[model samples]
Target: MVVDDSAVVRGLIAKWLGDDPAVEVVATASNGEMALKNLAAADPEIVVLDIEMPVMDGLTALPKILEHSSEIQVLMSSTLTKRNAEISMRALSMGAADYVSKPESTREVTTSLSFQQELVGKVVNLAAARRLQKGGKVYKAGKSSSLNEDILPQVSSRGAIAKRKMSSTLPRIIGVGSSTGGPQALLKFLNSVKDELRLPILITQHMPPAFTNILAEHLARASGLPCKQAEDGDVIHTGHVYVAPGDYHMIVVNEGGKKIIRLNQDPPVNFCRPAVDPLFASLAGTFGSAVLGVILTGMGHDGLKGSQDIVDAGGTIIAQDEATSIVWGMPGAVSQAGLCSAVLPLDDIGAKVIDITTGEAL
Candidate 1:
């Protein structure tokens, strides 16, 4: 289903999606109210919702759509702005599956190849996952260890785990990477570990300008930690959280026996500027075995090679398992590549991080 206040925007998106044989444009609504009224009849597996709309907004409609059908996936759409990003993150926390940042100019909807690809890709993946879930062949959140082999064979393969002696030394720094469902996941994980952690935490979440600032504020409120967007040459301090600013690649550099952040615009990796790879690889070089790397829910393999660098440096890598991930592409890639030390569910990841850092358990 496509829900938006503008008829032209709705038609454009519907037409674009209609060209793809992998998806069917089941329904289109002018507003949230209209969407809910016709939702039962359309019974769509996925909903493409616009954040700002008349009569009702995406945020208000999101939970209602999910309440109508627990299996339905809602993908919020918004222009690249701080307010929309904040709302989108809230929507994810409210049970929306994921979100897409729409082009500011409506004309770009047809002209921009990246926008079209991202929209179609997320819809297809979410729909496919919903179908598998309805068929009783998918893993639910908090059930990573119970993953069905036929659904995720790589997750069941014992050979995927690297053989390394668990480190007893506490980590000096923590590096985390996430996308898609990252905001909510980051909030939850950070809140859970805030009281126990003393190490500086660095995060690379796929976001645009202004959004990262809002995300940092949200993280600070949720985790009770001083979190802010990284600035060039900013000193890395213990117990502080730094978020990679939008459109900039954040990397850690050692200078004069101190760590500092370096932000650059040296092209994008894996189609993302604030990608996970550079941060992870840089941390591997600086902290080596004393770094704790985490790969969380995301839509691509951005963190795979960087995770390998960490593992090869004798550092430990932990991934959020498929069951709890909104899209398991990042973590799944790391897990399948035989790089992760632990593949755990979202609920257990925070505790596991604390345990690893405290040398309490693997």
Candidate 2:
């Protein structure tokens, strides 16, 4: 289903999604109220909702829609303004599956290839994940996660962690990579163990400039820690979070015996600026065995090579389990490649990270 105040926008979205043989647009509505009225009848697995509407905006309708059915995936859409970016970030925290930035002009909207691709890709990925999550069966496992052979979904519960040995020394820094359902997942992960975090944190979430800024604010609020966008030459310290600014791949360098943040606008890696590869690789080289790399829910395998770097450097990695990830592509890749020391669900990742960094995983 597609919901927006503009008929053209709704029609365009439906048309784009319709062009894909794998997708079907079940319904369309002019606003949130109308969308709610048609919700049950539409029975849509995903809803692309516009943020600003005449009666009941996206923010007002998000929780109601989730309450109607938590299984239903909601994609919040709006022009990428500062205000909309903030609301979109808020919507993610409120249970939205993901968000797409709309083009600002009518001409741009009609001609924007990126917009069409992003919207369609998200819908397709989210729908597939929803089906997998709904149908995946979790079974009991014996001891080691390495021995579990269940391939359709997650093999076992939290106890069935990857059997790889953890790093002997405590991690000096933490580098995390996430996309898609990243904002909400990041909040949940950090909120669970913020009080016990012993090292500085670096994050490379797949977001544009405006959204990344808002995400930093939300992270600070969620974890009760100082969080800011990484600036060139800035020194990362304990208990602070530095997010990669949009369109810049943030890497850490050792200067004057301190770890300093560096930003570059080189061509995007894996089609993502501030890509996870650079951050993870840099951490791997700098911290060596003391690096802790975390791969979270995302659309693609951007962090795969970098995770390998971590593994080769004797660092530890913990990937989010497929059952808990929104797309499970990135983490799934790392998990399948045997790069992670533990494969955990979203809820358990925070505590698990804390345990490893605190030497409890030994």
Candidate 3:
């Protein structure tokens, strides 16, 4: 289902989506009220909802839509702006699956290759997840043992964790990578561990400039910690959280016997400028065995190579389990590669981090 006030925009999205044989444009509506009226007949698995609309807006309609059908996945669409970013983040917390920054001009949306790809890709992925849920085969954390063997042969349950002695040296820094469902997961993790964190934390969330800035603000408020977008020459400090700014690769460098943040616009890695690989690799070089790397829910395998570097450097890597992730791609890649020391559900991740850092567990 596609919901937008402009008929042109609706037609454009519908046409683009129609081109993909894998997806079916079941319904279209100009407002939230019309969309609700068509819900039972359309029975869409995924809904592309515009943030600004007549009768009712995306933020107002989000929870109501979900209430109508708990299985429906709503993807909020909005023009890139600080207000939209804030609303989109709120939508995610309120049960919207994900969000996309649409081009300001509706006419240009269909013609833009990047926009088309992002829209189509998210629809396909979210729709498939809904199908999996309907078929009773959806993945869940702590229940990996019950997953279909053919679909996830490489996945291991918590009981299968490899035995290894944790280093006596505690982690001096923590690094996190996430995409897709990152905002909600980050909020939960940060809020849980903020009081126990003893070192500065670095986060690489796939987002653009305005959105990243807003995300840092939202995180700071949620976690009650000092969180901000990383600056080029800022010195790393304990008990602060730094988020990688958009369109730049954030890495750490040791200068004058102190670790400092470095932002680079040097080409993208894994099709992401603020990619996780660079951050993990840099941390590997700086802290070696004293670094803790976390891989969270995301759409692709961006963190796999960087996680390998962390493991090779004797650093500990923990991944969010498939069941708990919105999309299990990033963490799944690391888990499949047999690199993570622990594969935990989202709820357990914070406690586990505290245990590892406090010398209570490996």
What is the C-alpha lDDT profile of model 1 across 179-204, one tens digit per residue? 87798889989988999988999999
Q: Write the number of the candidate with greater TM-score, choosing between 2 and 3.
A: 2
In the range 304-330, model 3's lDDT, one tens digit per residue, is 888889888888889998777876778
Q: What tens digits encode model 2's per-residue C-alpha lDDT throughout 1-362?
A: 99988878889999998887667799999889999999999999899999999978989989999999967889999998888888899999887889999998767888999999889877765665555555653222332121122222232232333446787878999999998789999899888778898799999999888778889988998789889988999998998899999999999989899999999998999879989999999998888989999999886688889989988999988999877887777887778777888888899999899998899888
- Work out the TM-score per prediction: 0.86, 0.88, 0.87
Worst ten in a row by lDDT for model 3: 144-153
lDDT of each: 0.83, 0.84, 0.83
User: Roughly what TM-score does model 1 have, to 2 decimal places?
Assistant: 0.86
Poorly placed runs, candidate 2 (over 4 Å): 105-108, 128-162
* Candidate 3 TM-score to native: 0.87
Local error of candidate 2 at residue 200 (angstroms): 0.4
Query: What local lDDT does model 2 show for residue 244?
Result: 94
Better of 2 and 3 by lDDT: 2
lDDT of 1: 0.83
